[model samples]
Target: MAMGIHKFSKRRGRGARAPMAEINVTPLVDVMLVLLVIFMVTAPLMKAGIPITLPDSRAKPLDQTPKQVTITMNAEGRVFLDDDELSPGELAERVGSLPRGADGAMPLVTLRADKALEYGRVVGVMGELNRAGITAISLVTVAGGAPAETAKKP
Candidate 1:
C-alpha cells in the first residue's frame, strides 16, 4: 500500500509544478492595454493649453466660408497673423495689402484669442481690421452651447 501511494503522489506533483512554471501573462497584457487607451484619449487635450474661463456673449454664427486670415491675441496684447509673428502695425499693413478676389469682396478675417486676454485688445484688432478695409470679420470659438444672435444697431 505504501509503494502504490508514493507513485500516485509523484504524478500529481509533476502537473502542479508545470502550471506554476508557465507564466500567466493575461493580467500583465490587460494592464498595458488599459494604459495605452488612457494615454491616447488624454494626450490631445493636454497639448491644447491651460484652460480659461470666458465671458458670456451673444453672437451670431457666420453664414459662409471665405478666405480666412487668422489673427491671434495673447494676454500681453501681442498679435500674430497666420503664425507669421507680426506686430499690430505689421498686421494692419499686411491685411491692407491682401488683394480682393475677382468678385471684389474683402478677404475674411478670423481672430483667435486666449480667454484671459483683455477685451480691449480684441476690439483693437477688429478696429485695425476695419481700418484696413476688411469689413467682414469672424471670431472663431468652440461650440459649448446653442449659438446666440446679437441685434446690430444700424
Candidate 2:
C-alpha cells in the first residue's frame, strides 16, 4: 500500500500543472515607455511655425495671447502661413477667413522673419496683414543676452 501511494503521489505531481494567474507587465511597461519617448521627441516639432533665424530683441516678451496666427518668412522671400507657403494675396484671404475669438477680436498675428531677409519684405508682409484687417501683429525675436554666436546673421 505504501508503494502504491508513493506512485500515485508522483503521478499527480508530474501531470497536474497549474496555470499562471499573474499577468506579465514587463512587456506592457516597455511598450508604454517607447510611446512616451516618441511623443516627447515629437511634441516640440508639432508647434505651428516655420524655421527662420529670428533677430534679437531687448524688449520684454508679450503676454500670451488667447488666439494666435503664425506667419513666417524665410530669407529667400518666401512667405508661409503655419507651414503652408502662400502668396501675399492668399495670406490675406486666409487671415480673413480665420474665426474670431469669443470677444469678437481677430486672432493676433505673429510674424517670424529671417534675420537675413530685407527689411522691406518684412514690412510688406505686415502691410498685407494690415490690409486684411489684422491689426494685432507681433514680431517674434530671440530675447536679448542670448549667445550672439547662436544667432544666424542674414
Candidate 3:
C-alpha cells in the first residue's frame, strides 16, 4: 500500500513537468501581429515627398536608392539640393568634389525637374552633371501624378 502511494505521487510529478515543456506560443504570436500592423500603417505615409510634377517617361525604373544626389529645378529654373538652393555651376562643383563610393566609382546623380521648366534648362543641367563626372544620371519622377487623377468628379 505504501509503495503504490509513492508511485502515484511520482506519476503526478511527471505529468506536471511535462505540461511545462509545451511551449506557450500565444504571446509570441501576439507580438508578431502587432509589429506587422505597425509596419503596414507607416509604409505608405513614408513614401509621401516634396510635391512636384514629374515628366512622363517609358523607360524602365532604375535600381538606385538611399545614395543618390537630387537636383531639383523649379518652374523658375531655380535649383535645389535636397532643399538647399544652389546654382547649376555650384551643383556641378559640389557633386564633382564629393568622395567616390567604396568601389572607387562616381556617385549617382538624380535630376528632379518640374514639368513647367524649359527642356533646354533640363538639358543644360544634364550636360553639367555629365561634365562633373556623374555619368550615372537618373531623371526623378513621381509615379502616376497625372492631371486626369485630379479632374475626377468626387
Best by TM-score: 2
Error of 3 at 23 (Å): 14
Q: Candidate 1 or 3, higher lDDT?
A: 3
Q: Which should have the higher lDDT, number 2 or number 3? A: 2
Write the candidate numbers in order of decreasing lDDT: 2, 3, 1
Give lDDT tens digits, candidate 2, residues 6-75.
5545555556555679999999999999999999999967864567778988778877766877899988
How many residue pairs clash in model 3? 0
The residue ranges of model 3 lying beyond 4 angstroms of the native Cα positions read 1-49, 142-154
lDDT of each: 0.72, 0.83, 0.76
lDDT, candidate 3, residue 142?
A: 59
Tens digits of lDDT, candidate 3, 1-154 = 6655655555654463333457889999999999999999999777425556677654666775666677888878888876678864797788788788889987677788989988999999888888888777778775544433346588
Report the lDDT tens digits of candidate 1 across residue range 1-154. 6656555556754463334457789999999999999999998687334233333445555554567677777666677777667854787788899888889877788777777787887888898888989887778665555456669999
Q: Which regions of candidate 2 deviate over 4 angstroms?
A: 1-15, 56-66, 142-154
The TM-score that candidate 3 achieves is: 0.60
User: By summed lDDT, which 10 consecutive residues of candidate 1 come out lowest?
Assistant: 47-56
Indicate whether candidate 1 or candidate 2 has the larger TM-score: 2
